[model samples]
Target: MRDDMDKVIVERPRRGGSWQGDGRAWRNSKEAGSHLGMKRGYHRTKWLNENLAPLKRWLHKQVHRPWDKVYAELCSGIDRRSTVQAHIFEHIDDFVERGAVMRDGQVWVSASWWGRGGRAPLEEASHVELFVHPLTGILLPNRRLREARAAQRTRHGTWAERRGDKPCAVYHVIDENTQWHRVDGCWFEVTLAKFPERVDAAKREEKRYDVLRRCMVTHGGAGRRPAPDMPTHASLYGRNDVYAANKRQLGRREVRARLGDDA
Candidate 1:
């Protein structure tokens, strides 16, 4: 409903292909395939094995079905230049063109698993909750969704936007699972997993920052006791962007040590 969000794209521009795929029209859309008694591939196995699966299992346990499977499948349909380009972050032009990906106040916002219906937020996560930028939530505004749908409509012209569309955003929750959620407002995508080698890894730095932010008291001192559960900094993620953002303030080794001297 609201627009006017971040233009804070990765400073480097995307030198990739157009986001032309929209699974809805593909002869093999998972949803379409379901009708014909088939299943569609969602995301790359690496993304699944490394990032989404564990969270999916937990969320499904709560909601009785994994919603990400649907969203992932939809994302899978978005056409790109190469396998690497299948990533969600690569298609900012579409976001910019349609405006689905907009800054919420100052935070970026986009639809998460909104239309898929939530399976559940992960449990037993290291961090129970996350926070938005207060003024910088990220968003996938109307145009972004429209462009995505237009991409989908290339094949799924039979369906309508108001029918399948939803408003969603990703979450940065840590604990039992780490996947997207279709919630109002902006939710940070937090994790404490191993560093991502997938993309340029601009976000790992951020994860390390989360680690330091979690470990230190307001005055920048370490906690006397580790969290009762999980390894040191077990909940912090080490993506590249987050890392680069805070590099001058901290170093990789120092941040990793917050997880532990061994990490």
Candidate 2:
């Protein structure tokens, strides 16, 4: 690999009109021997190789590697900058010519660099092969894996999931006393065991509800109830609840009255 990379540097066009159009232009220009030129080339090579070199090696074989394997290799030390990402986009065609295509996952390669307006090809011929993703700079086979990964991250962060017919908040229980909760779009660690008072209060509140139900049952569904009185009706009516007052309850007398003949 080192020999191959060294050969590439040695074979780079030293001086020509062609160099003017490529990244080596400033490095090989008349001012190239000066301190400023050397500094310019040094920074460019450093930043460029920081991401591009491994990618070249990864594709040089044209053998299919897993998306994560490639991702881990290319992105290892990358602090991904817009400039570097753009540089990768510019060189993507060179790799495509080397017969590289994503073995798995989608690549969202676009003519537009970094999703900013730019000159796209007159036709989509060049993209029939491989393309680099603008945002992640990682080559994907399609958009499905990228979008799915994003959605998974969102669900994990928000503690939300689709259950039955509705979206519901999810609590990931780590243990009897510990769980994760999403609050205000951030995840928080909650330790139920640490709050003995809250645990006691919850138990007492549950007992109160049980006692209140028994009281309602014994007092023929009417009573001067417990200290914290239950609301007679919901304080606010939702669209679905406006007709709730007439709904039949098995515990109520109306069902028995209607069933007198059958009884």
Candidate 3:
């Protein structure tokens, strides 16, 4: 939130008056750009919360296509945010070079692209959680929820970063930002209510097994069925009867030369 005035190479022209009228200040494009970029991020986050907060509860209904609703709302919100960030991102290097914004050493964003792209480059900040949920799919006890919420962070990558790098926590560090982004291969941001579940200890160990073991284990649902530790892993009980009846219609098939005669 602090401006890197110390890093501002050229003295900001003294404010003879309010922005437009000030001759000494706000005189040129670069200085003006820096100011706009820093401020726009705030406007964008406020707008998103006002408009999209309702979808959080609406998305949880267990129904035929509730996920589709969640996806649609998220796409709209994230895209709006990204659009704003892209606008502010245009002038970040001026600030960054001077230390207005701080970043990690492993930079996923390039200063040149971010600096020059103007308002066109901001990708939606999707599934952005104002409220915290487990990065893992399971709903934790309230005590655990407080802990998870405290540690929650936002990041830039498309998929949930299960590795715990806390990727992209800076995407909105200053209320606004710009970067390349997408969800389901389309450009947008998604504020997730829940973080994707982490691999359980057994599943982590299972990855080392051969393909044959994987097939056998899945085919049998056999290892001491792990506890219902995650909401995502909870059994899908409702739709099985409906889907099973129609399997022939959805099942794979092959063609043969004149079925009876060929056989």
List the candidate numbers ranked by TM-score, top first.
2, 3, 1
Error of model 3, residue 45, in angstroms: 15
Best-to-worst lDDT order: 2, 1, 3
lDDT of 3 by residue, 109-204 (tens): 222423343221111211121211222222111223222322333333334455553433211111122121222222222121122233664553
The per-prediction CA RMSD against the true structure, in angstroms, equals: 21.6, 25.8, 23.9
Residue-level lDDT of model 2, residues 92-198, one tens digit each, is 45554222233235322334323345333312223323444443444434313333434445555433343333332433444554444333334344443211123
Candidate 2 vs. true structure, TM-score: 0.21
Please report, as a residue range, the 10-residue window in candidate 1 with the lowest summed lDDT: 1-10
What C-alpha lDDT, on a 0 to 100 scale, does residue 209 get in candidate 2?
Answer: 20
Against the reference, the lDDT scores of all candidates come to 0.30, 0.36, 0.26
Alpha-carbon runs more than 4 Å astray in model 1: 1-6, 10-12, 17-122, 125-226, 230-263
lDDT of 3 at 16: 27
Error of 1 at 11 (Å): 8.5
Flag regions of model 2 displaced more than 4 Å: 1-3, 9-13, 17-60, 71-108, 112-125, 131-263
